[model samples]
Target: MDAKEKPETTSSMPQRRPDCIKCFDALWFCYSPFHQMQNYYRYGEFDNCFGKWGDLVDCLALKTKRAAEAEEILIAREKAKPHIWTFRTVDEASENWWRMYKHLVLMSPPLPGAAQPPPRSDKS
Candidate 1:
């Protein structure tokens, strides 16, 4: 707290890159017919966020300007992108579903410390 001394500070947050695609998507949402229709119904006129279009344009330009670094990140993301795993056959999917159903419906026990669930009241 001395006049000539600097305050001690510490920060350990990870840096995150701003995503250009989010800006592009926001711009598209602003221009969608469904949104315009909703605006018309609510206010008796259509409205659009043209400023979001400028955000998208600026993002694209920045990406182009930093192509060298951006390209490296893009390459890493392309290589790391995950495809969902799937059951190859209908029978395989059905078998897995039945196994899960049986486990939950018949085999699993209540947690040791938990009270039994109340019986569900019929609504008719």
Candidate 2:
């Protein structure tokens, strides 16, 4: 390298987004209430059960937040697919709505540009 000359950079590696790896890894254990209930309540520790339930809810919320973020990326990648306007039946719509509600509970303000059902028009 000469004076007044910048050194050439070799790596053009793109920076990766910071994923909460530890959170994802620990979620497998944290979300399982079976172990906690078996070990704690079985030993007559009733108070711990309530606390454990709270902990589990928090963990689930964290997992959902991460999943919603990943879902956005997947949706973008699948944009080339034809977009359907309505559900074929009420049962299918209800099921999908329930799933979305659970997954996006912690996702504040909801996702932008999300698809909405067409407004119903009364012919009467």
Candidate 3:
């Protein structure tokens, strides 16, 4: 077979992912019709290849390891602009944000210079 007559093959191509900066999470992307159609050519039913909790965890681990190797703590936060979408109502959107704020407050570690909680008293 002549080289010029051979059909084009993608064997030498690298894997690709959609640059979804607006994506929230894996489930959201996986269920999104837009993403489904976008990735239809590469991966039809495997949306997790781009976005997943495990992928985030792995990224954190790698970053942490690299920071430790460099003798630096990975303590940083980026203020992100929230994505706006139509909710049931303005009240519903406010409530959703309030709930997320509460969750963060409960789960986050004490901030620097914040009062430490009282030590737990154990009864023998």
Candidate 4:
């Protein structure tokens, strides 16, 4: 019989793995700089080209700092867990926290105009 026609013989595949929070965090952390750069390059509204470049550099530095901090937290968590019973939960929480942190980092900050009040008049 054709393989297609025969009953499935192989064991059913396992459930698709949930996104590993740690992996997701790392992915977001890595993606932020590129995303910010793309947005800035595409929009091109800044007063000077150099300012945009500076923003890009700043964004990259921010992402790098975040990644380093996350790594430190992960290392600390691993070191603190001597017993196995709590290991799985602690690891999962750490991964989720890191992932959420990454997500926050990837999110674009409020537009400058949105955050800043209009320039005040000297007469006041």
lDDT of each: 0.68, 0.55, 0.52, 0.52
Report the candidate with higher lDDT, 1 versus 4: 1
Model 2: residue 18 alpha-carbon error in angstroms: 14
Which 10 residues in a row give candidate 1 its minimum summed lDDT? 8-17
Best by TM-score: 1
User: Across residues 80-101, which tens digit of lDDT does each residue of candidate 2 receive?
Assistant: 6766874458856755675677
Worst 10 residues of 3 by lDDT: 70-79
Give me the runs in candidate 4 sitting further than 4 Å from their true place: 1-11, 21-31, 43-124
Q: What residue pairs clash in candidate 2, if any at all?
A: none
TM-score for candidate 1, residues paired by index: 0.36
> What are the per-residue Cα lDDT tens digits for candidate 3 across 20-116?
3333366466667777777786765535554465555545554445433423222221124344753467656655565567666557887989644
lDDT of 4 by residue, 1-124 (tens): 8767977645574322223454445445445766557656888632334544554554454455555464565566668978766545764675556556755544767665543322344743
lDDT of 1 at 56: 80
Ranking by TM-score: 1, 3, 4, 2
The alpha-carbon lDDT assigned to residue 112 of candidate 4 equals: 52
